[model samples]
Target: MTAVGAAAEIDTYMLAMPSPDSPVVLPQWISRGNTHPNSRYQDPIWSMAPLIDNPGTGLVKLHWKNCPGPLLDQVKLAAWTMINGQLRPTYLQTRGVQARSRSGGTDMLATCHEWMRLARWLHERQITSLAACAETEWRAYANERLSQVSRDTAAIICVRLANLWAFDQLSARPSGIARPPWEAEGVDDFLPAVGTAGGGENATEPLDPRVLGPLLIWAIRFIDDFADDILAAWAERRRMVAVAAAAKAAPAGWAALEEWLLPMARAGHPLPANSGKSEIQVATTYIAALTGSNRGQVSRFVKQYGLAEIAAERPGPCPLRVPVTGRINGEPWREHVDFNEAAELMKHLGTAATIILLYLTGMRPQEVQGLRSGCCPDPAPTADGTDGRRLIHSHHYKNVTDDDGNHISAGEVRQVPWVAITPVVHAIRVLERMVPEGELLLSTAHHEFHSRHGHAGALKKHTLTLRIESFVNWVNREAGVQGLSDQTIPEDPQGAIGLGRFRRSLAWHIARRPGGLIALAIQYGHMRTVLDARTSSSYGARGRGGIHAILDVETALAAADTAARLRDRVAAGENVSGPAARRALTAAAHTPRFEGRIVPRTFARKASTFLARDGIVLYDNPDAFLICAFKHDNALCEPEPGATAPRQYDCRPGCGNTVRTDTHAHQLRERADELDQFAAHAPGPVSKRLHANASRLRETADTHDATAHSAEALT
Candidate 1:
């Protein structure tokens, strides 16, 4: 802890922590290939009953399976917790969750694989720990990767790089700028793209190694996170199914009830990492229900069960069962052995319902998990034109803005009107058929999964990824399909899919498919840019005087068409912009002005940046350029899910809009020549500042036309 003066100290610290004999162990290699404990517990076929429906009666069983930690997983979880001690609650509903606070007697220190990697990064950069910073506190917009987490999560991979470089804890930092330490190449990744025409030195100053330690830990954490993402995805779905089955089950005796509740809730149990407290509570409540008790009387019985040791300390196979009456719509929602394949989905009604809800509403898992029985529309405000359609309202929302663009308080309602999709409808139908009979659309006996970290029905950020992963796996297994890609990115360096992919996929479909939401929503305020027009924004934005609706029907169609083509182009190794070249140019020529100019449209350039921004584009493709490559000379956005290498794209004069000229023309692909004239021909003061930090940029079509073009070349 004393400024990490030597390598031996790290060994000393590890030794001081959990001994090898401890039940909790951090192994030598932190890679995904590392071995973990396989669960030894297996329920008799008869014990395999649903837990939620009969919480008060059925037995509570668990098999503690080996759970691996991913670097990013640790970062996200740790970063949030580190920022304000905000551990989420377990959703037992019978009571709220509270953590024992301490001054400093027991503090935790977590970092990436080695202290040196972190030390180098931290020692070289000047980053103010967002753990204690604020949005308004930023006086200048520096370009360091600045993230403030609500949970104690951090990306150990990127963040750790900064911690080991420099240790200037007390030096003044540039406003808004931040940095991770230099990489193995001995170069910092998050700096202003230098010498580009318009780039600036985004780093305010170099950070001391000690000050940058937090970042190194955060980045490596992400690396580890992605590595373990696949396994975690599988475990998550299994957990959800169990928890859901438990929520509606009948309560059991005190012994069973105590087994269900104590781990995540009562004093002796430490909340399991990754698993939310709410989900656990939901499972326990249902487990108790199966044990033969009701929610009201379950608490005392649980305490007794705790005294008796009925609650298994680990996780594993159990008989997930339900009473005959527990059948959802006269069919077992969890087990339907009597039903044929067609009737089986009647069992997966929950999974399908969840997937549908998430995709349609675009709400994070936390929002859905926090949904309550009464969290419906007021019917007071005249239902907007979108009334009959399924709407998403975030009631009791925290850390998010409402539909009206208002910030919501913790436990406040925030609703988002969702465009219903076929899947969403399917999910609703399933939910209608499987409604718990006693609570909200999504409910639990104690609402444990929903309240994973802290409260009666608490939800956390990871809940989204966890639930989505579960749904996706079920979809893959149940659909009996392979090679199907939704919006998710690939998880394996060689694999091809993930969760965030859904949103992007949705956007891609909407942007590329003429019939998708962004296109259709235009008539109803899902706007797009029209060069020089008063209505230049999309979806909706408040302008100088009026709340202008900038969405359009034609442009939507064009963009959607282009988005679909982009997929083929991506597959064919072409830039996303190349596929939509003429269309983007046309749209660019007609910039619409709502309250102000909509964003500058960089079709090919955007594709390059996006590819670089996300690892979807092959690293070796010379054309791949960070979207901000032109925006900032030095900064490289983090790659998207599924990417492993950190190489640039295949370069071409017209590949994308930006590239790094500092190293070589081929260092990155650029779409510079394709940028709209407004930017390409922008006054020197503007254009100069834009790419100056970058070493150079490709010549625009106009420049080519003026210099070397025949009339045909000009065209």
Candidate 2:
């Protein structure tokens, strides 16, 4: 056919094409219809094409046709053939044939790009089709790929090429073409083993307690004491707006009277338009002066009639000018409200509340962000029936997937226990007031720059991330100005704090805080209880999914760190405390010094299998005031079935499982001194009791001291 005739024919074929939303079979490629008949078929992975500069024009353009034209056309044809089940029986039986189910345009695009790269490599070696490439060429390509990108990336590239080669071989055999030598070869042989990418796991460090401490303390004070100021300010602004609207809608000459009277009202000047001198009295005097009316008439107009008009014409809600004054990181600071500041304060309040809930409840970031109005409407008594401990009902969205691997819209609501912290509950109530009725607590309003775009409902992960970063920056800046550098959350060396790190950090702190020294110093006694409950019971219940996985990893790391510390102490000849001191010392002696191996260190730290063979495992229990050298059923610390660790809160003082460090010995000394001081000041029975407690503390301290001296002498 002539060129013009072929062009006309192609145009007619395009015009006769099915709708993009409809599935239709392409001629010469497939006989069957699309697998996903209800959904539109797309050539996946095409959008990832890189833009390249046109060497002739120096202009950048998307290199859509960069792949070999004939090969590209053949791939497109193969895609249709695979989708419609027109492939050979051999191809149909292959495990990789399932790639056909990934019919999206992006998926096809990625496959096409990989095929194009292989085709280019073959062409460079003077080979034509994939069937012409030998094992040597494939090896060369694999080597080139490994040198260019990550092992995972190279593996993906090889896998895609292998799939395409398999398809090409299946197609060629039917057409009487010879198979390529590389066709039967496995890409797996050339590719490195790939595991799940860590992706910021190492980089996501927790917020420092030094910073979080003051930040939360300020947040509590802000929510408890200063949050009401926002409401009052809002009401005042609304009232002013209502008065202004009423004045505008007043009688024909009232606008002129208002214009004349407002200046005098603001200036505290006695209006010549009215009679009285005082500000309140001058308002009636101002009306009389302006309208040429008597004082009695003006008084009645101001009180009974005009005042009712202003009250009736109430305006819609207006932005509030909240008064903010606080000492961030121990430095006093003050801020006046304007439009931006008011919006910012509102956002800060929301973020503060979010931080408190996440930090205190140990809830995942998504779980906290997913919190809607009336989530925790009523706080009930905790499982233990503790007076101050309460349980909050909230939803968790992670792992809420349907049978088809799609996430359900609404999350599963679970009752979180021991949330009886008053400040946290108070923060929740404050958040309730900040948002409109039935709206999300951490809504788009918390995004100050984006609030004007209307209520976007629940906070997105990225939005919360940005807000947290901004919140941290604001706290740091405010604290810096107040010379409270010590109180400021320091910039992490790994990276800024992210939402995922909170739960892990809490677990780490609980498992590793030495003798509850830092925990007690930080005033997190209640938190220690919560952490213990979560680590012991909740960890196993959740089955190592989502946040539970992070907690498990951190817990293992904490255990390893504790073991390492114990080893160092033993090496330094420092005496071990507790009933299991001898066993703990033996285990410490066996712990191999970790040089530069992370995987082995992680294994040694987390897994008790090796330690179990020797009848010992170092268990961290900071709240128990000593580490536990647990020996399964023989543990002096009662071991709960199906629980990997002992309950620190239920720790027996003389339990053979316990192993105290030097810090514990120091604490005993301090306690002895404290008791002695109390006994000296007490009278009669109290004095006798105090003296007895002091003597016990002194004896324990002396025992630890003597052990330490003996170990030193032996060394």
Best by lDDT: 2
Q: lDDT of all the models against the reference?
A: 0.30, 0.52
lDDT tens per residue, model 1, 59-131:
2222112112222222222222221121112211212221112011011122223232222233344432432
Best by TM-score: 2
lDDT of 2 at 396: 69
Residue by residue across 635-685, what tens digits does model 2's lDDT show? 654444434555544566666676777776777778778878888888989
TM-score of 1: 0.31
Global CA lDDT computed for model 2: 0.52
User: Can you give the TM-score per candidate against the true fold?
Assistant: 0.31, 0.60
